[model samples]
Target: MAGVAMQLFISHRVASTDVAMAFMIQSMAFVCFNKVSTAQYFVWYLSWVPLVLPQLVKHSGRQENKGLITAAIAWPFGLAHWLAWAYLLEFQGYPVHLFVWGAGIVFFAINVWCITCLLVRVSSS
Candidate 1:
């Protein structure tokens, strides 16, 4: 799988923590673009979050980087929204295909924004 290849590439090629963070961002991008992505797929990249959290926190302490912090905070809420819609459609048999699609789009946008903020912070650090 692409994720496995990416992880292996990062492990073998990345010598710096910042570069590893960048690869993690790329992994998140891969999940966003994957047509058949499932909730469990998120674990692939989220597993790196704690490793980079100290860096993120260091960058977020600046007053002007509040937007970055906000995006970080908002991503999970976006995921929850997407999951709620997915659950309704899958389990409740709700006629909400449009809602699910819309939620998916919004979640994707939030994810992209969060990734962008992280990339900026990671690169600038």
Candidate 2:
């Protein structure tokens, strides 16, 4: 978990309330405190990283490379992570389950739908 987390994101600054940092902390706890296995946690973290960053960066000001916003579009996975994790904690042992499944399905589908919409807009431009 720690090894994979080290690569999750790079924030030399104080990192603040970002999802990566949260997962990183949770990863540490799962591995260090609860003795959770690393492989599965790594996969879980990766699946959720995309959904987490934006809210973290909401206070992060602007990206150093504004053009990279498209790439950073993955950050919203953090928001999904927050919501899904909450639902999981309330319902699925906090590890992620069917309750959060809707969140993932919606997030991924909306992701595709939004991307297609954006592409259409760009092309029409």
Candidate 3:
């Protein structure tokens, strides 16, 4: 049901902004439905991140200035995902643990911030 809604949201094609926003919304939604989620679940959205990266840069219009700041946000988001997955692999045989939970929350927040930046750009434009 949630996945379908996300797909429907993505189906709209008014602009590149719409695609980027839809991707972000769907990514955040992935975290919403699951009570217990692994880092693997985020793989779907991580793929979309690169696709939206340029959108952020282009919209911001400050690659020389905000470029590093944008990258600063992005690198940690990616690292957090990697760490979450690493935790997942180290205990593949075991059930979901507290470590992933903590990482999940942290990463989710970072993703939300990333999405928020895109969203703000969209609204401002």
Candidate 4:
């Protein structure tokens, strides 16, 4: 799976035990949130965008600033997930849309931060 590959790649890049496990826990959370709509499916994928950077880096075989490039490609999903969460919250409420959106925002923010920090560190090194 892309998610597992992502964890392994990042773990190798930084050699951080905490970062490695964080990806796995997040992957499980994304998987466990079963039975969602099409939009929700994309958002779920977006939530995993941060982890995917390392996988993309590995796949690309680029030697220079690979993580930064992959994070750039993945950035739109993070922004889109935030916007989609907002739209869903306003248009509907039957499915506790507000709660879901809030959760999505939190996930998006965390992933965005993680990816940003990782890319910055990787780039500066």
Best by TM-score: 1
Sorted by lDDT (best first), the order is 1, 3, 4, 2
Ranking of predictions according to TM-score: 1, 3, 4, 2
Local accuracy of candidate 4 as per-residue lDDT tens digits, 1-125: 76567556655655553454346435434443433433455454456557655654553434445555555555566556656665666676445576666766665655555455454454344
Report the number of the highest-lDDT candidate: 1
- lDDT, candidate 3, 1-125, per-residue tens: 86676556544532455665566556656564556565576677777767766755664655343533674467466656747666675757556566556666666566556545544455555
Residue 65 Cα positional deviation in candidate 2, in Å, after optimal superposition: 24
Q: What is the lDDT of residue 53 in candidate 3?
A: 62
As a TM-score, model 3 comes out at 0.51
* Residue pairs with backbone overlap in model 4: none
Q: Could you estimate the TM-score for every candidate? A: 0.79, 0.31, 0.51, 0.33
Against the true structure, candidate 2 has what lDDT? Answer: 0.44
lDDT of 1 by residue, 1-125 (tens): 87667556544544355765766777787887688868998998889988877767774547437878788788889999999999999999999999999999999999878767765676566
Model 1 off-target regions past 4 Å?
A: 1-17, 59-64
CA RMSD (A), model 3: 5.3
